[model samples]
Target: MATATYPPPPPFYRLYKDYNENPKSIPEHPPPIEGTYMCFSGNYTTDDVLPSLEEQGVRQLYPKEPNVDFKKELGSLNRELQLHILELADVLVERPSQYARRVEDISLVFKNLHHLLNSLRPHQARATLIHVLELQTQRRKQAVDDIKSGEKSCRNFSWSLSEP
Candidate 1:
């Protein structure tokens, strides 16, 4: 297999086309890392340079965030979506043109539900891995048992033939 270049050049390497083309005129100091507090920008988006973030609304989590019951939350959202859809149906039937807010509510519910499901992806992957391992273990045990049974039958046949 071909070896990949170690510590491949940063994404911004292309920006330094001149230096790459002529290797000797390197700058006096290496370029600062992308997110460093430089030039009065004060590391605008880096977590360390800013106060604690209080981001609002729905956001996904990886490997399942602690203390949140994904199953219950999903159930609640499912119910909420069902309710919104029912409300939308009523509005469509009674006042066909006045369903905008109901549609918006349904859209919001769907977006939240999607975000919640995405947060469950890591959890689902782990669960699937565990189930696959369990099946593999069961198959191994069954194979071992079958081999043992076959060994017993072979020994029984050899003894009977020897006695004859």
Candidate 2:
């Protein structure tokens, strides 16, 4: 079989290259991801401005995570995110200037993923607490059993010594 080669990714992806691995790197002060930086370094150039969330008019699709299965929804979103990422990267490579819409789609997917993961946080926390409590309870039971055995041994020794 012949080997296939691929081209490198567009420079635009550098903006969020670390986001999945280190979400904390996302700038906090700006609601819409605006920042002061050079034109080529993922920030917008002077003539072209990155749209704000207000400009995009973003709104909650649902007040809370719907009754749908979370794992399924999460999987769907993960795939959707990958698709949007590729679309954005491809557009940047081909049309460069026409990346605003693609960027918007990618950001929307990111927001959805963020929401889904957050909804699962409470459950993860509760599970961890339950596991710790269960382990602690097991340890306590073991300690009690050991103490009882020691008491029995002491009583047997006393009775044996007292027997004439």
Name the best candidate (by lDDT): 2
Per-candidate local distance difference test: 0.73, 0.75
User: What TM-score against the true fold does each predicted structure earn?
Assistant: 0.58, 0.51
RMSD of 2: 19.6
What's the TM for model 2? Answer: 0.51
| Segments of candidate 1 deviating more than 4 angstroms | 1-66
Give the per-residue Cα lDDT of candidate 2 at 101: 94
Best by TM-score: 1
For each candidate in turn, give its C-alpha RMSD to the true structure in angstroms.
13.4, 19.6
Candidate 1: pairs in clash? none
Model 2 alpha-carbon drift over 4 Å, by segment: 1-65, 149-164
lDDT, residue 162, model 2? 100
